[model samples]
Target: MGKKTTHKFKAEVSQLLDILVHSLYTNKEIFLRELISNASDALEKARFKGQAEGAEDTVAPEIRIACDADAGTLTITDTGVGMTRDELMRNIGTIAHSGTAELTRLAGEGKESLDALIGRFGVGFYSVYMVADEVEVTTRSIEPDAKPVVWTSDGRTDYKLQELDEDLPRGTKIVVRLKEDLASQFTNAAHLKHIVNKHSNFINFPIYVGDERVNTIQALWREPKFQITSEQYAEFYKFLTFDPDDPFDTLHTSVDAPVQFNALMFIPKHGDDPFGMGRENRGLDLYVRRVLIEKQNKDLLPEYLGFVKGVVDTEDLPLNISRETLQDNILMRKISSTLVKQVLDHLAKMAKDDADRYADFWRAHGELFKAGYMDFLNKDKFAGLVRFHSSGLEDEKGLTSFADYITRAKEDQKEIYYAYGPSREALNLSPHLEVFRRKGVEVLYLFEPIDEFVMDALSEFDGWSLVSAEHADPAKLDKFESLEAEDKPEPLSDTEKPVLDKLLARMKDALGDAVTEVKASARLSRSPVCLANPDGNVTSSMDKIMRVMSKDSSIPKKILEVNPDHPLVRNMLTILERDENDPFIEQAANQLYESALLLEGYLTDPHALVGRVQDLLTKSSGWYVASEK
Candidate 1:
């Protein structure tokens, strides 16, 4: 054995060490993940190089993890092109590897396009000491002529390397001497198995904990697209999502461009399960060239897509000071932005490729798309992926693209208009949509409840505004010539008009001034009346859901738009005229307003309307006895 020679870290490593030892990583056990990941990377590299030489022996396949608690040690070994003396000093001791130096040297070299050649380094190696009091590396190059070397570090300020002759093997072995307190973690085989399974289970290589293979997962990201069968993706989705249901949509892509990355992402068929359990999803995982970076990296996807499961492999992320503290990391941010763009772009293509399939995806995960549309922060991209049902399409409930909406728009139409209802049938009957249907104008039918806020978030798509069908002022039709005007519905007689007008004034008094200039409604066709928010602060759909769930929230003052045309309105007018002294007229007015609300998808007590209906029935029958009560 040679004398233990120690050398200090390069400035960056020294700065990085302070960060790692202090608070860069939230958990110390991630050291195992980092070291094991490096072993896997090296093993994969050896496998690639071995393929060049036609070496297919399983003996030197890739990676193996062995734990020795008696010595308080955990060893990760890889039969790779192990480091030579100069390579060890350059790679391990000084951080002067050609890859790092070349990156710095060529930094200003045209957009810093060194991504094709550069991968991560240094940090993943030093991370071992977070768990181990001491870390030792025994390595031998597969070169037939090169000798073996060992490197040792306590992760303080220095490390040492020397020539070594062990039970002669051509590979690299990392042995970690666990701190006395942490010894029990590796002492119990089950605990060690847990860490490996959680962090490194999908490592492309076979990882053995004692005699059993612990990492049985396939690194599906790197496999060729054609080679990955749907069965494989489905099986992988089960493991990835931990759900029994099949995927809602799966996107697997390999790109070699601005950077090299392999990614597999799946939109789960069921988010309600985990969400119902009150689980906060961690979003899609992050990886680097097939090595696990973090199993639940939130930054890899938006919060709305937190239920999705998959892996993103980028070879160029800096691994932070500790591989664990990757939030808001510079390279990670860039990668995340790029990933969002890619996912949105792919989804847009999917929608364009097959309308039926994409509509099915919309049916399965439309809320997520709406959420992304609202808050994804990638507006331009998300705008393309959104799908909706439009009355403009040929079939009932047939879907239309935003682009299709644009194309079908009137020559002078400067905005896209949509109406919200609980059902397409309901929308078709909505009093608010009367003029739109008469004018042959198309409206996107927003059946979803949250789409009101979602549209507010989206605001506009491709320079066209999103206008709500409910709140669009009929007076605003002054902007365009009335398409056609039929005779106004027969007005109540002058004698009856005063009573309705007087009653409407009283009803408006009961509702607030937010009701804005209420008169007999021109919009109603067959409906008695409908409630509308004139200011558009809340949609009727939103009001219904909130009132059902929240005790403190009062239903907003809704404008009662009554049909002077409908038979119910006519009867109310006649009753008001016949009995100016009758309290039943006022009760009918209140019930009519409330029933209008019910029609608008807002909740209402039917007993109140039913009681009023019976009141009128009893008054007409002249059965004002105890039987009426």
Candidate 2:
């Protein structure tokens, strides 16, 4: 041995090491990831230096991991640029001192490709102390004159360094004497391979656990798009997500401005968490140079796009010392905005180019994607992508986008009309849609409870206000001519207007505070009555959903709009004309109000309405029998 020496660790270095071994990493297995990543970085530096010198016989770079269960030890060897004694001290003997960062600084004025280097915080290597009772590093520098050196440390207070007399191959080898408790976990070949595959599978260098190479999957996102085939993408996606089915769509994009990143995003053929049971763990696997920094990082994408699964590798992110979490949220937000735009642009292109495929995407993800209405930055793009069942469609299965609806809309239409109900059939039967149907106007059907909230957030799209049919103004609708002229009931004969007024007064009196106002509606053509929001504080759909959520059985009072032309209302007017003080009048008014409540999904109890129906049946049956006699 050439001279063996001992050195005390910097005070801060000792403090940081304690943190790394005790509390820094959530998963101790990632120590392997840190070592492999450092090895990869060394290998990349060697490759870049060789390429710069036009070297043709450079050694092929590879990482080899050997697990010795009997010895309770794990060894990792790499064919890369080995560290000089000075470099070893500067890189590993201090806290937050990074070899990769030093190389970057030295290559600053040169046109060097140092971007592949992964170690920036310098603390990653210390993570090995998490699983090791003692660690030894044996390295021989690629420089011909540099002597071989060995570094040994128990990772507590001090370390020893020695010059080796034996010749060794270029690069570094790490031998970890595993902690007694963690020996079996780290010494098993299969477990070691799993750790490599999980964190460093896409590393440029081949990673071997024993003789078998574990990282067989290529980093397709780094490869040129034209060179990668659809089959390859599908294979990679299946390998990444473990989804048996092929993706519905794939978005492979590289962004160079504001932030640089390689994103390989996929819209799965179907959502794995359709019911949102496992939605808590959502977002892309965040990687820095193909090393997974965070898995299912929820910050990578908005919650609305949680269904999207993929990998996002960015070198520009400033990671915390542990490399487990991001340090700068501003940079992350920029990346998020860029990703949102890319996804939106991809979907928009698909919608325009492949309607059938886009329709499939919509069907599989529309319920979740509809939550994007709150993404105000991309509101226009989101508006263009949302699909709805419209009155114009022959069946509920057919869907129309807002753009398509606007295209087919009458020139005078300024509002995009939508109504919320349980289903298309329910919406079709909605009393609020009577006038819209008469005017041959297309109304979007909102079936999901979130649909109302989505519309409320969006408010408007492409200069057209999104107005609920329940809130449609009567005068603006009357301006549009009826699609087909209907034989009209003459306005209650002029002399009978007074009787209709008396019936309205009687109905309002019967309803008491159950209604804000009881008034004849010019918009209603078929339904006897419908409720409208008195002051628009809450929409009918939202109110019903809120009530259901709170388990409140009480019905909210609203404006009752009665159609004078409907036969039910005309008959009620005659009933009032004959006997102004009849109990049937109050019963008939209450029955109409309750029936409207039932249609609006607000009526919790039907006992009174059912009894009234029975009484009406008894009276009508008796009258029919007397007529037959």
Among all candidates shown, the one with the greatest TM-score? 2
The best candidate in terms of lDDT: 2
In candidate 1, the residue pairs with backbone N, CA or C atoms under 3 Å apart (3 or more residues apart, or in different chains) clash, namely none
On the 0 to 100 scale, the lDDT of residue 4 in model 1 is: 57
lDDT of 1 by residue, 508-621 (tens): 665546355457776556567777776666666666666767764554666677777777667666676676656665676677776666676444457877877787787767
Report the C-alpha displacement of residue 74, candidate 2, in angstroms.
1.5
TM-score of each candidate? 0.75, 0.93
Give the CA lDDT, 0 to 100, for residue 593 in model 1. 70
Residues 187-276 of candidate 2 have per-residue lDDT tens digits of 888888888988899999999999999999899999999999999999988988889999888999999989999999999998766787
Model 2 scores worst on lDDT over the 10 consecutive residues at: 111-120
